[model samples]
Target chain A: MNTPNTSPSPEVTRTYRRLIPNTWWLKQRSTILFMIREWSSVFVALYAICLLGQLWALSEGPERYNALLAKSLSGGSLLLHLVMGAFVLYHMVTWFKISGRIFGSGPLSPGAVTAVNYVVWIAASIGVFYWIF
Target chain B: MCLIKFIKSLEPLWWSLFGLGGAIAAFLFPAHILIQGVLIPAGILPKDMLQYENFAGLLSSPIVRIYFLALIVFPLYHAAHRIRMTLEDLRIGWLNAILPLLCYGGATTISIAAVVVILRLS
Candidate 1:
C-alpha cells in the first residue's frame, strides 16, 4: 500500500457546496406553491385548535357553548373561517394529488389513484353531511 | 437489518402519522368545513346544527369522541412534521436539536389535552 501523504498537497479541491438563499422558494412559481402547500399545515393545525376550542366549549356546559356558537355565527367569524377553509381545501387538494404517486404504481395508475381519492372524498363528505342533517 | 432499524426509528413513526393524518384530513375536513364554516354561517344550513345539546349528544358517543380525536390529533402530528421540514428548508436549522422535541412534544401535549376534554364531554 502506498504511504499516505503527510505534507500539505498543492491545489487540492475543497468540497464544493453552493449557498442557497433562504428565499429561493419565493423565486420560482412551483417552489412558491410548494412552500404554500407545506405552510398550509399551519392553518390545518390552527383549525384543529379551533375545533378543539369548540369541543372545550361543549364540555363547559350550555351557556358557554351557545355563546361560542353565537360568536361563530357572526359575519366576521364566517369570513375568517371561509379563509381558513380555503387553506384547508388547498392542503387537501395538493395532498390528494400527490398521494397518487406515494401510493405506488402497482395495479392502479396514478390518475386512477387520484380519481379514487376524490371519489372517496366526495362520498365521505356526503355521508357526514347526511349523518349531520 | 439497517433498513429494518431505520424503519423502526422515530422518523418513520412520525412520517406514518403525517401520511395517515393527511389522508384523513383530505377525506374529512372539506365536508365538515363546508357545513360548519360555510353553509351554516351562510344561513343555508340552520345554526341548530351546532346547538349545544345536539352537539353534546353527538360527542357523547364513544366512537364519535375517538373519531374526532383522531381527526384532530393525527393532523397535528402531520402538521408538526411538515412544519419541521419547512422550517429546515427555510434555513431555520439552528434549533435542529430542539425542533423535533418542540413539534412532536407540542402535538403530544395537545393530544393528551384533547383526550382529557373529549373523555369528560359526557
Candidate 2:
C-alpha cells in the first residue's frame, strides 16, 4: 500500500487563510454574543407591545379593558409572563456584559452603573405595582 | 480621535442604553389604570401619552414625568443605535455615512418633539 501525504496542500492552506484569519475565531465568538444580546429584545418588545394593547383597551372602555386585563392575567398570560421574565433576566445579564463595552468610563463607576440599573428596575416595578393596585 | 468622531461613536452607547432601559420599563410594568383607562380614553390626555399613562396628568407629576422621559428618550436611542449597528454589519460601504446620520438625526428629531410636547403641557 502506498502512503498518502499527511500535510495539507498549499491551495488548501491559501483557502483556509482566505476563509478565516487568526483573529476570526475571536470575531466569530463576539458576533454570536452580540446576536444573543440583540435578539433578546424581540421578546422584550413583544411583551411591551402587549402591555400597550392592554392600555389601549383600557382607554377604550371598561368592558374592553376588563376583558383585556383578564386575558393578560389569565393562565396563558401567566405562562407568557414567565417566559418574558426569563427573557428579561437574560437581557439584563447580556446587557451588563455588553455595557462595559458600549459605555466607556464616565463619571459613574461600574458598580454605580450596575446599581443604577437595579435601582431603576426596582423603582419601575414599584411604580407599576402601585399603579395596578 | 477627532472630537466629532468620538462623539459620534458614543452615540451608539446612548441609543443602546435608552432602548434597553425603555424596553425594560415597558415590559415589567403594567399600564396605570387611571392613566390608561380614565384619562386616555376620555380623550383629555395629551397625544404623546405613554402606554402606562392614559393622560397628561402624570406629566404634571415630576417623578412620573422623569420616568416617562427616561422611557421615551432611551428607546429611540436604542433603536437608532441598533439601526446603525445593522447597517455596519451589512458592510455596505457607501451607505454607511448617510445611515448613521439619518438614524441619529431621526432619533434626535423624535426626542425633540417629545420634549416639546411635554414642555408645552407643563
Name the candidate that leads on TM-score: 1
**lDDT by residue (tens digit), candidate 1, B1-101:** 45434433689889999998888778888788788888898999888879887898888788888888888999899999999888878876577556777
TM-score quality measure for candidate 2: 0.49
Candidate 2: interface RMSD equals: 8.5
Candidate 2's displacement at residue A76, Å, is: 2.3
After superposition, candidate 2 runs with Cα above 4 Å error = A1-30, A100-112, B1-84, B87-122
Q: Write the per-residue lDDT of candidate 2 for residues A1-133, one digit (tens) a residue.
A: 4357677768868744233332332467777666655555555544444543543454455577566655654456656665655655666666654554456367866666666666765676666646533
Docking quality band of candidate 2, CAPRI definitions: incorrect
TM-score of predicted structure 1: 0.90
True contacts kept of each: 0.84, 0.05
